[model samples]
Target chain A: MSKRVALEASHACCEAVRMADTDVVAAYPITPQTHVPERLAEMVADGELDAEYIPVESEHSAMSACCGASAVGARAFTTTAGVGLELMHEVVYIASSMRYPIVMVICNRALSAPLSVWCDHSDVMSVRDTGWIQVFCQNNQEAFDMTLWAFRVGEDPKVLFPVMVHFDGFTLSHVTEAMFLPEQEEVDRFLPKKRQYQFALDPDKPMTHGAFGPPDMYTESKISQEVAFRKSKELIIQGWKEFGKIFGRYYYPVEPYRAEGAKTMLLMMGSLNETAKLVVDRKREKGESVGLINLRLWRPFPFEELRQAVKDAETIVVFDRCISFGGPGGPVFSEVRSALYGMERMPKVVGFVGGLGGRDVPIKDIEYAFDRGREVAEKGSEEIFETVGVRGKVEGIREPKGVYLPAK
Target chain B: MATKARKTKAAVKKLRTASEVTWRDMEVGGILTDAGSAALRRTGDWRSERPILDKEKCNKCGLCWLYCPDAAVDACEDGYYEVNLYSCKGCGICAEICPKEAITMIEEEEE
Candidate 1:
């Protein structure tokens, strides 16, 4: 029988790791993500989980230790947020490109200039190209579920690449919610005991890891890495399906809520999906043609799944908490547009950057953004980028008062 | 300097050149087969200059062998030390360390 417990999302992650019997937990402290390692350390100290808890000095050292541990055929794990993730940026690439199968939990936080430690997607967006399998969680239960699933997906013989499971900083990490914690025996049955790596850094059979490739072989080396990552999608599906069979809670790469036959849809990620689901329900009650699409899989992007979900919709209002600065619209909006390209019929994609630097994007703001997107689609407007719920007005701003204008 | 060449042979592993490598040989995750296999790679092409030896002035002090960074210097049966041109980087370290002043660094002649 599964144990029902009320746990903060961060602590739930630690519980999941403990249940999975992770071999190593290496991490440094940062806001919103600190509770995870703290609980993990307590578990290791109290003899609850027999694992090496490496209390690293910096996030860089944490990731490096994870790389070393995973390379030596151990199941390594770590957690970080915002600046800490940025500090470990270089090693993040090394971990994935080397295919270490290190699992990481990221408490997504806003980046600093004014230095606010709050919930946002800037941190994970910054490292999107690092080649790690990245996923987002909407609530505490999903956070707990994904943490276990990450280990299974990453350590599969076919997919030896690293995996990162992200949940919003204070939004999910600090909030307490009821979750079903599976028994250790159940987890052990679901996740394999044998740790299989493409190349083990074992003493008996000596091998080189992260070897320096000359210009002659660098391109081919990257091509091989890409092919391996693309192929991992099959194993990811199989792993999740197997987890569902045991746990009774299934998950999808691109999960849709009330999206059937809706003319207009709101697309977002992380905890905002829960808020958007509420707004979708309210809109439906009022007989509005609106729905919601939660993008759970960010890397090894579910392009085909996403295209199928939004095919019938007339407009897609993509809410991006992170900005692309000088480029087109927001980061998630760019991906959605790119995914819709070459399709016979595509929805009019509109971008709304909001909730930056920990600002609250209330349900009303989301409704307004959706209405604006519907208006834009009806008008057939070429300009489709806007920022939701900004305080003061800017000079010479048009219809949607806070449209993000790229510097001329 | 005369030592018996051992009957038990260690196999010589050659590092594949760019053209010699096939896509199938490229391992996933870029993990290499052998750790520290640089010894299999001949770095002779990195050299711009070659060391010329004056055998008459060579004192057989073995200073060149002691200082050869690439370990290209070998003790000859005739008491003099010779450079294995295939692996010599021609860094001039052997010439710099030679007390007999028998070694000279000269531009490598094109074959």
Candidate 2:
């Protein structure tokens, strides 16, 4: 039987890791993400969980340690935040290429220039091409559910890729919310006690992992990994179906809310989707044809499901928490546009950058997004994306003409 | 080292070389299931200069075998250390380390 309890999102993630019966945990302390490993350490010390808790000096070492643990066929897990994720950026690629089924929960935070410890998608966006299977969480329940699901999905023999579970830093990580906690027996049944690793380091049967690939073999090796990664999407969907069958909580790659016959839709990811859903509800009450699309899966980008969800809508307002610098709006916005580029009857996709670095996104801001999105669809705008709720005039800060020479 | 060499020989017989395999045939994660598969690569073709051993001047001290980075120097049954040209990259470390000056590197002419 599953029991309901209030838990911080970080602690909820740790509880799922415990239930997964992870063999090893190697993590460094970082804000918002610190509570996860801290709680796991306490669980280890109290003999509640039998796992090796490695208190690594830095995020680099933490990920490296996980690679080593996972190489030896151990069920390894880790957690990190903004800067920590950046520090371990290179190793993140190695984990996936080597096909280690290590699970990590990223307490998503803003990248630093002004050094703010807040919630945003900047950290996750940077590692978008790192080859790890990534999923975003909208609330505490999803955080717990996805962390557990990550292990089962990643460790499957058919899909031995690393997984990253992302949840907003202070907004979701620090907030307490009620969630269903399943018994260990049910979890054990879902994820078997014996892990079947196709390749592992063993003295009895010697095998080489991460071997030097010569120029002749490098391209073929990369192509094989690419094909395998793309094929893992089928297994990901199947894993979710099985989890839903047992747990009674179904999850989809792109989940929709009140999207039936809607002409306008708001597409978003992470914890902000919860707030956006409420805004959608209020809009619907006022006889507005508004709907919400929550992007749960980030990688293996769910291009098909996204297209299907917005087929009926006339315009999609994509709210991105991070900017793509000078590029065409945010990363999500660019990909969404690219996906809908050649479609026969595509909807007008408007990009908006907001809620950056822990900035509170009030109801008025989301309402403004809908109004502005429809306006842009009707009368096209010159700007690539509009900033939501930003103070001061952005038009005044123009580049000084002839001061900086143009490249030849 | 001897057991690993034997295992490599056995694995080489059963497995196809990496170049002969396509992306569909490659193992998951590109992990080489057989240990010491590097021996099957035959890197000797990379050699611009080949090491020549003088059997008359050789002391059979085995220093050439000990210093060969690629483990290309093979100790024969008669106790003479000979360079196995198939695996030698011709770095000439064996010639440089030979205490008796029994080895010399000669530039190979294109066939």
Candidate 3:
């Protein structure tokens, strides 16, 4: 039996992790994520979840420890944000390359500047190429479900890669919502005990691991990893299908809202999906043909799904939480445009950078993206692919100077 | 058993003993170049900068030289990885991937 409560989303996520029964939890506490490891620690102390909780000093150590634990065949969980993730950047590659199913929940927050702790996608974006499968959640309920589902997804032998469940810090992390918390038995029955360590260091097996592959074999090694990752997309679809069977909640890489008849759509990731949905509904009431498309999965990016979602639509307004300075376009927008480059009727994608410091991007502003999408359809083309919001004209279109981390 | 494993390690470390293995000496007998690369930049150097180990860390791992597609790195001793620099174009991938982080890339500082 489960109970529904107006609980904090972070707590709900931690509860799902506890219910999923991860074998190992290693993390260094940071804002928004503090509630997660803190809750797990309490559960561990109370014997609610039988797991080894390693209190590491830094996110790098935290990931390294998780790698060691996961490598040895333990289901590992960790959480961090912003610079913590930046520090763990290299190990993140190691975790994925080694094919250790280390599940991580990131409270999506801004990378420090003017030292902002607010919600943004910058932290997750900075580690985008770290080779982990990334997922974004809209609200508390989805956050809970995805956190639990991440373990099943990552630990799938076919998709042995780390999964990061990202929710907007302060926005969804601090916000209280009535979430349906499931029974431990239900979660256990739904998600199996991580099968025999998919890749194990067994004396009997005596296979070499972490050994340098000769150039003759290096390309093969990389091709194998790439091939394995490409193949995992089907595993993701099957996993989602099974999760829906058990949890009664469905998920998609790109989820469409009121896109049935809408000619233009406002697309975003993370918590802004809800805001965009509300704005889209309001516009639709007045007979405006606007819709919202939420990009749930990033890595093994649902390119085909995204193309299918906006193929018929005349325009797509992409809200990129993090900006790729001096690039052709925003990272999300660039990818969306590239994905549809082969489409018969490709939606014109316009990029927007808003709610940067975790500041609230009002529903009205989402409406603005739709408004710009309409304008672009009528205009020749959007000269600046980036949508400049009500705040200020996009300034200093150059790299923000900072000290380089000496470590590679 | 431990001693046997140690001896096996010693035997594997034999490839790095050569003082120098130069590009001129390389036969290029075996490596099949990709047809695409061959068509695009037929004369292009695909080799990256790899460490030509001076027998210091040659534990006879055979990983470096065995793994060197262009025969850039070789093994001299048991469990050691060495680089043959004549063909190495300074890719630094060996440095990044070394399990022991034994390989280091010292960029030639410009004056």
Instruction: Give each model's whole-structure lDDT.
Output: 0.86, 0.89, 0.74
Task: Return the interface RMSD of the candidates, in order shown, one decimal each.
Answer: 1.5, 1.3, 13.6
- Which 10 residues in a row give candidate 3 chain B its minimum summed lDDT? B35-44
Output the worst ten-in-a-row residue range by lDDT, candidate 1 chain A.
A393-402
lDDT of 1 at B69: 82
TM-score (chain A only) for the predictions, listed in order: 0.95, 0.96, 0.93
Order of models, best DockQ first = 2, 1, 3
Candidate 1, residues A138-179: lDDT per residue as tens digits? 999999999999999998877888999999998899999988
Indicate the worst ten consecutive residues by lDDT in candidate 1 chain B: B4-13
True-vs-predicted CA distance for residue A341, candidate 1, Å? 0.9
Residue A360 of candidate 1: its Cα lDDT? 91
lDDT of 3 at B61: 49
Report, for candidate 1, the interface RMSD.
1.5
Best by DockQ: 2
**TM-score (second chain) of model 2:** 0.75
Candidate 2 at residue A81, lDDT? 98
Best-to-worst ranking by TM-score: 2, 1, 3
